[model samples]
Target: MSDIRINISNKTYVLAHDTEQFHHAIADLDFTVHPQQFVCLVGPSGCGKTTLLNMIAGLDPHFEGQINIGQATQSPTIGYVFQNPRLLPWLTVRQNIEIVFDDKPPTSLIDNLLDNMQLFDAQHQYPERLSLGMQRRVSISRAFAINPDILLMDEPFVSLDAPTARQVRRLLYSLWQKRPHTVLFVTHDLREAIALADRLIFLSPSPMRIVSDIEVPIAREQRTDEGCVEAFREQLLQNHPKISELL
Candidate 1:
């Protein structure tokens, strides 16, 4: 198995304004993420789940520790999908996705993504013309256009309505299955975590620490079935009661 061992030892962070009041965002977080594995980070609000993700993305350099991708060194090619779509209003759907590709991707690849995302008909539509869910779909397509080795997503489906969110989740899982990159997804939604992750990492309240690292035994292909999804949901609630309350 291709595994990325992450050993974050004795790492602590303090607010920029309050140096003396140290907040232990991540305290001795030691875990390994297998390559092509889908991992989820779950915790209460302000528990520093996103902070830990930022550290992995190499956006925050102040923390003291090491985050090894596969070897001892770090991996620079990382793609991020934030809570908001963050698409350019002036650009059309095709243009937005094409932006990630410096040169054009093969016409077939672009068309395939657009069709899979259900955005093919809206290719010429600008962000302002599409609904919020459509815009987010475009954002997701754009993120994958670069084909980064690692993908970091922070609650990409949190704001959507239930039906739309579920649809997007299925799309995301399909995409991840096809191109298995090292994905670290952060979310408070237990169902979302269970539906997409190969392993689930739970964090404690503020000054987060690794409370649990549970493997999701269900096969990726089986996740779309209603029975499998419901079972996973029940298991998540039973296993992580504290984390459930945060959602």
Candidate 2:
């Protein structure tokens, strides 16, 4: 197994704005994400969760720290799925997903993802032609099509209705099972975190230091139902008392 260690040590950030606020976004944070591990970042709003994620994605270079993946000096290939679907209105579902492929991806791979996302029937449909949930599914497909080593998801299901969100969550979990990747998911939803994470990292508000790093005890293969999800949710709540008040 490839050992994937995502190290963020003594990382501090000071805003460039007039305030010049001194914030240690991730203070002396050290966590090793083994290959194919699913990790989730859970915290209150404005907890610098996204800031930490951005640093890992190499989107914010002004921070004081080092983020290493394996032994390579260069950053790993990343695929990001944001809160909004962010699909192109001009393109069909197939075209949108295909755009992510730098070189031509295997047709079978694309087809399989479309089927898994329940987007096979809507392959020729434009973004406007699809519903919000469908568009999000397309976005998920697009992200996975790139075959990234690290997948960064920032509240990808936050905009959907409860039922739709649950469905998408299942789809995402299934895809992760098929093609295991180093995933770093950021969400305020405790249920979502418990349902998908192999390990959970809880951050404090403001400066956003790592408050808790927990290994979820549930087995991934059995986490396919709401009962199993709720069980883990309760476990998380029990472990982190602060999360209950925030949620």
Candidate 3:
């Protein structure tokens, strides 16, 4: 388990470098993600959720404050799942997954992931031939194969149908349990946030800042069922009025 600490005074991107005009993206954001914790960042579109994730992943270094991930050193091992399954169309499903690794991971790990993700049958198939859901599954398998210490996901289920999203959520839960990592998942949907997060952090629109930090006590399984979902929704609406407004 690795602890994380983040303190961002501001996130600014120059819109017109020559004119020195900039867009203030995020401001005064402070938070922490405990080792192996599943934390969700929820806000309206264009908020700094993805910006923050990118900073943590070390993609954008032009931020104001400090982000101290556990064991501050060289780069940390990170797994990223984007809104789309960014698989290599030319590669076979198995090859697409293995390409991410610099050193070869054990055969058992690869076999287990392929078996668990139900991609064994499609391992030799190219990404273009598989259904969207199957391709996303392969993408997920690829992420886990790297054995990441921190996993960053940006609206991973965005374009999927409701049923497909639910199915993926279940598979995600199973995968997380198998190898728990410090996960920072971003989404604009509050309902989806409730379903996946052990801790919820809500952000305001850009320039963004933390508005609410909540610990979700509801069990993951309970949060997904129909009756329990409504109950959880009502509880959130009562307790966090701001969250409802954004939703």
Candidate 4:
């Protein structure tokens, strides 16, 4: 795993029948993510957050830019966790995770992941039988199972209830601690970003461009404390009044 370099001059989409009508999703967006660094892309809804992730993940190649993962000739492995747990409904929890592997997966690693995520017992259950939180856990487990160089997550905790989201967040942090992969997580929620990211990259509304990149000073362990998180947020807003407007 190495640094991720991205430079996008412009990313446009056709809006209507008229050739002149176009929507610029991103413009002049340039940034680099250090290896094993956790950075959150924070912005208002529809601010091209997902589009940027798509480009980085190589899911969309129509944009005008260069996205290079590492120095190697072969592209690095990428793990993506979408907004929803797109698990196979018919497969059991364990099977869903195993399918990501082309050949036989390391049983020890799979078992460790299952034990850590508390999915060991539920591994036999189908997606429908599990709660939304459990399903998301499976999605996360599957992503990490690949041991990818980069991990891209898109609001994996958006629709969960408060407590469940908190639990999932904790579990994610724990997993990252064990094997810290380069992470680019997308979310509109500033507080959530503050809690999980080592740095926060704020973007403008549509035709999104970099507005601010603030390094988080609070220790990751201290972020769980709401008071500490709130204080950092307040201080950040005070330092950069412009960022508050986007949120």
| Winning model by lDDT | 4
The window of 10 residues in a row where model 2 has the poorest summed lDDT is 1-10
List the global CA lDDT of all models: 0.80, 0.81, 0.85, 0.92
Report, for all candidates in order, the number of backbone clashes: 0, 0, 0, 0
Superposed model 1: Cα runs more than 4 Å off: 10-22, 72-76, 239-246
Candidate 3 lDDT trough over 10 residues, lowest sum: 220-229
lDDT of 1 by residue, 1-247 (tens): 2466666665566567745777777667778887777899988888887777788778876666677775546444788888889998888899888887667556777788898889999999989989888888888888887777888998889879989988998988787777768899999887778778888888888656787788888887787776887887787678767656666
List TM-score per model, in order. 0.88, 0.89, 0.94, 0.96
Q: Give the clashing pairs for model 1.
A: none
- Which of candidates 3 and 4 reaches a greater lDDT? 4
Clashes of 3: 0
Selected candidate, larger TM-score, 2 vs 4 = 4
Using TM-score as the measure, the top candidate is 4
Q: Write the per-residue lDDT of candidate 4 for residues 180-206, one digit (tens) a residue.
A: 999999987788899999999999998
**lDDT per residue (tens digit) for residues 13-117 in model 3:** 988868888889988888889988999998888887777888888889998899998775646789998878999989999899989877875778888998888
> Model 4 misses residue 63 by how many Å?
0.9
